[model samples]
Target: MNIFSLEGKNAVITGGGSGIGLGIAKTFIEAGAKVLIIGRNEEKLREAKLSLGDNCSYKSFDVTNLDAIPDFVTETKSNLGNVDILINCAGTHLKKYAVDTTDSEFLQVLNVHLLSVFALTREFSKVMIKRQKGSIILISSMTAIMGMKQVVAYSTAKTAILGLMRSMVAELAVDNVRINAIAPGWIDTPMLHKATDNDLPRKTKILNRIPSGKFGMPEDIGYAALYLVADASKYVNGVFLPVDGGAAGGF
Candidate 1:
């Protein structure tokens, strides 16, 4: 048997219309799984589906709409049958320091990154527990592991995700439902470029710090995510798998 094969598995990837989420969707589909990509942009989702082909599907839904999640989960299950994997990659970023950040902004960030994610996990893990099989991946970031400027809200949410994963594992592991977090380092995505393009010094500083000496590709995170949900990692549980190129551990 192919230990890495995800054949017959059905996956739901939030924020899968672009960047790392889209990369994960592509990898999952290539590994023989059916993927449903969700995001707030219908056009992007349509384009992603077109590129990913028939094995891929999509839904345009705002994750922050917490009340809509239950219905969304129900509809997804009805359409996709059983969700073998769920990826919480949907999030919003705020580039503001703590002093400048307002209460509304911080709460908004938490609502999307933390609250929505928990709701989805709670709803989906129930079905997985009943079936006694499932893998859930939360997309975390370097900010969660270390300090970063102008991303206090983002860091807090990501850090909380790790806590959420660890807490869920205690309950879900007994049923063979594994939940974990992937902390991706600086990736070569539009988001990264947007943060670095005009700030050459910052970009250089980031690149210099990474032992790999270069920014990582979105697929880098995808492959790590694939392993977490694949049969190869069945024994692994409640871990913070960092896909950063030694940046988190390096000087």
Candidate 2:
């Protein structure tokens, strides 16, 4: 057996119109999986699809719309087949001190990043369980591991996901469905640029923490996603792979 092959897989990636999500979609498709990406940006999705080639397509939907999840899952399964892999990569970032963070803002981020993730996973796991095999990838963050100020909402949501993954592991494993997470380090994306572009000191501090002394690219996470979902990692289940250039271990 080819350990790295995803040749007959069907992958669904959320937040896949741009950045890391798009990167995963592209890489997955290249690995011979048919990819259907979900996001709110139709134009960006179209552009992404064009670049990802014939095996790629996309759907436009706001994840916060909890009422639409069942239908979306049904439609996705119908359109894409059994959905061998599900990549939960959609989320928003809010930077604010714990005191300054509004109740509304915190809940909004949770609804998108945490709650919707649950809804989609619950819905998709139904099909995957019946098939007795599937890979579910959760996109976690560095904030989830290390404490960082001014991102209370984002941090709370991401940290909560670790709990979610652990709780579901034993149950999901019983049915042969694997759930894992990726905690990415400071990646060089427009969002990261926007976060630190004005603060050289902050950027420098972040870079210093990373032993590699450079930010990672989206494809870095993409390739990691492929390993988690592909044949190579069949025995791996519920592990959080931190693709952080050794940042997590820094002093």
How would you encode candidate 2's per-residue C-alpha lDDT over 1-251 as one tens digit per residue?
Answer: 46887899999999998889988998888788999999998999999999999999899999889999999999998888888999999978787789998899999999988999988988899999999999999988999989998889888888999888988887899999999999989988777887899979889999999998999999999999999999899899989889999999987
Every model's TM-score: 0.98, 0.98
Clashes of 1: 0
Worst 10 residues of 2 by lDDT: 1-10
* Global lDDT of each candidate: 0.93, 0.91
Q: Write the per-residue lDDT of candidate 1 for residues 1-251, one digit (tens) a residue.
A: 48999999999999999899999999999999999999999999999999999999999999999999999999999999999999999867688879999999999999989999999999999889889999999988899888888899989999999889999999899999999899999998878877889888888889998998999898999899999999999999999988999998899
The lDDT, on a scale of 0 to 1, for candidate 1 is: 0.93
Worst 10 residues of 1 by lDDT: 88-97
Q: Which residue pairs of candidate 2 clash?
A: none
Best by lDDT: 1
Candidate 2 residue-wise lDDT at 90: 90
Give the residue spans of candidate 1 off by over 4 A. Answer: none
